[model samples]
Target: MSDQNVAARTRAALDAGEGILRLAPTWVPRSFLMPGARLKLSREDLYALGTHRGGIDERWFSSTTPAANEGAPPDEGLSYVVHDGAKFTLRDAVGAHADELIGPALNAKYKRWPVYSKFFDNLGPIPHHMHQSQEQAEKIGLEGKPESYYFPPQLNWTGNNFPYTFMGLEPGTTKEQVRRCLEDWNKGDNGILDLSKAYRLKPGTGWLVPPDVLHAPGSLVTYEPQWGSDVFGMYQSLVEGRRVPWELLVKDVPKEYHQDLDYLVEQLDWEQNVDPEFKANHYLEPIVRTGSEQEGFVDKWIVYGTVAGKQVFSACELTVLPGRSVTIKDPGAYGLVVVQGSGHIGKLDVDSPNFIRFGEVTKDEVFVTHKRAGEGVTFKNTGSEPFVSLRYFGPDAHSDLPKVGDYLKVG
Candidate 1:
C-alpha cells in the first residue's frame, strides 16, 4: 500500500478506537527455556512454532520493538492493531503518528515508543545473564536494556518449579573470582552459581534490574517492564544439565573479545554487583499512589525506579472490585494486559481467556493513547471478581512516581 494510504488508515483507526487501540496478542518464543504453562497459551500449541523455535512462553504487550530471536520474522515481537480485519504493526502507526499515539513530548524526545513490557513465564530458572550496557551493546548496534520484574499473585496461583532468583554477585565476591569462573568455561558447571545468592521468590513483589546486572530469574509468571532492546550475555555455562554454548556468552561481544575473560567480566557493573545492600537497592513492593484508592478501584505503583538516573519506564497494577467502575488518568501512553476478571475499558470489552491458540486475537490487551490516558478512561468490572490489569509507561510518564530509595520505608 502507499504511504499516504497507510497514514490515513492509521489515523482513522486511532480516531475510531477513541485513542485506545485494540492490539492482537504478540507471542514470543525462547529456545533455551521451559514454558511455565501459565500464560494461558493453549497447552497443545506450546510448540506451535515447532520445538526449534522453542515454546511460546512469553506474551509481549503492546510493543513496537521486535524480538531479537535468531529466526523470527521482521514483525515477531511487534504488536499489531486489529482494525476491521486489516492489521498494521504498532511500530508503523507510531512512526506515522507519534504525536497522536505517545504524545508530542515523548515523541520529540525518543521519536518512537522506546520501551515495552511482557509476561515472561518459565518452568525453571534461567542461567545467570546480564544485558549489555549501552556502550557494550552499541559495539554491535543495539540499545541497552534495563528491566524490572513484578510477580503478580493473581496469575501465579502455583509456582511452577524453582521459585528463587540469583541476582548479582555476593558483596565480597572479587573480580578475580568471576574471571576464574570464565576461565573454567570449558569445564562443567563453571561454578558461577556458587558466587551468587538466590532470594526466595515472593508474589506481589518486584525488583529493579539495571543494565549489566547479572540475574538468574526463577520460575514464576513475571510481568516485566523494560527498555525496548534485547541484548544479553549469559554467564552460566550450564543450566539444568543442558550445555550453554559459548557462542551465547559472547554473542553480543565483538569477535576479537570473544576469548577475553577480562572483557567478559567487564560487562558487569562491579560496584553494583558486589553491593552488600543489593536488596535495599533493588527490591520492590507495591505502594499505593496518592488519591489512587478511589470509590471502586485501587491503583498501586508496581514498578517505579530510575535506570541510570532516568525514569525510563514504570508500571501500575489497577484493581476494580466486582460491579464497580472508576476513571483512571495517567500522564503518558501505556500498554494494558488484563490478568484477572472480565471488564470494560470504556466501551471495549476485555476478558481473561482460559486458553489462547496461536495466531488468535484476544481482547485482553489494549494500548491507551496519551490523549485517552490524560482525559481519563473509565474501567468497569463486569465480572464477579476483581478486575485486574497491568499497564506500563515509558520515559517520565508518571509525575508522582516513587523514587528508588522509597522501598526502604516499606516495613
Candidate 2:
C-alpha cells in the first residue's frame, strides 16, 4: 500500500470510531507449546491453522510487532483496525500518523508504536528460556522483550496441567551448574529444572519479567503486556521428552557466536537469577487507583513499575457495577480487552463473548488513542453484573504509575 493511502485510511478510521479504533483479534501460535484452550477460541479451531502452524494459543492486541515464528506470514503479529468493513494494519497507521495514534513525543523518539500486549495459554509448561536483552538482540537485528504477566480471574478459572512456573535459578545455584546443563543438552533431561524453584500460580496477580531472565511459564493462562519484540532463546534442551534443537538456543545469536558457550552462558542475568528476594521484587497484585464503590466503579493497576528505570509499559483492571457508570481518563494510547461482563465504552458497543470462532469480529477489543484518553471516555455497566476490562499502555504511557512496592500499601 502507498504511504498516502495508509495515512488517508488511518484518518478515516479515527474519524469513523471517534478516535477509538475497533481492533480485530490477532492470533499467534507456538509450535513447541500445547494450547490450554482457555482463550475462548473454539476447540475444533484451536489448531484450525493445522498442527503444523501449532494451536492458536495466543491472542495479541493492538500489536504492530511481527511474530518471529518460523513459518509466520508477513502480517502475522500485527493488529488490524476495522472501519466501515475495511481494515488496515495498525503498523501502517502508526507509520502514517504516529503523532495522532500515540503521541508526538513518543513518535519522535521511538519512530513507531514500540509496545504490544497479548494473552498466552499453554496446557503444561514451556522450557526455561530468556528473551535477549536489547544489547544482545541488536546483533540479531531485533529489539529486546520486557514483559509483564497478569492472570485474569475470568480466563484462569481452570488451570490445566501444571499451574506452577519455574523462575530463575536457586539463590545458591552456580553458573558452572547451568553451563554444565547446557553442555549436557543432548543427554535426555538437562536437569536444569532441578536447579530452579516453582512458584504456585495465582489468578488476579502478575509479575514483571525483564530481559535475560530465565523462566519456564506454567499452565496458567497469562495476559502479557510487553514491549514490541519477539526475540528469545530457549535454554532448556529437553521439554517433556521433546528434543529442543540446539539451533533454537542460538536462534538469536550472531552466526559466529552460535557455538560460543561462554557467550550463551553470559546471556542469563546472573545477579537477577540469584536474587534471594525474587518474589518481593517481581511479584505484583492489584493496587486500587483512586475512585470508589460510591462512584460505581474502580480501577486497579495490575502491572506497573519500570525495567532498569525505563518506563516500558503498564496495565489496569477496571470494574463497574450494574446500572452504574463513570468517565475514566488515561495519559496515552492503550489497547483494551473486555474480560468479564461488558456494556459500553465511550459510544461503542462492548460485550465479552463466552466463545469465539476464528475470524469472528468482536467488540471485545479496542484501541484508545492519546487524545480520546486524555479527554476521558465514559464506561457504563448496562449488564446485570459488574463489567470488567483489562487495558495496557506502551512505554512511558503513565507518568504517575505505581512502583513495585506500592501494592504493599494497597488495602
Instruction: Report the lDDT tens digits of candidate 1 across residue range 40-86.
Output: 88899899988999998898998989998888988899999888788
lDDT comparing candidate 1 with the true structure: 0.90
lDDT values for all models: 0.90, 0.90
| Backbone N/Cα/C clashes per model | 0, 0
Model 2 accuracy (lDDT, Cα): 0.90
Candidate 2 lDDT over residue span 339-382, tens digit each? 98879888888999999999988889999988889899888988
Clashes of 1: 0
TM-score, one value per model: 0.97, 0.98
Number of the predicted model whose TM-score against the real structure is largest: 2
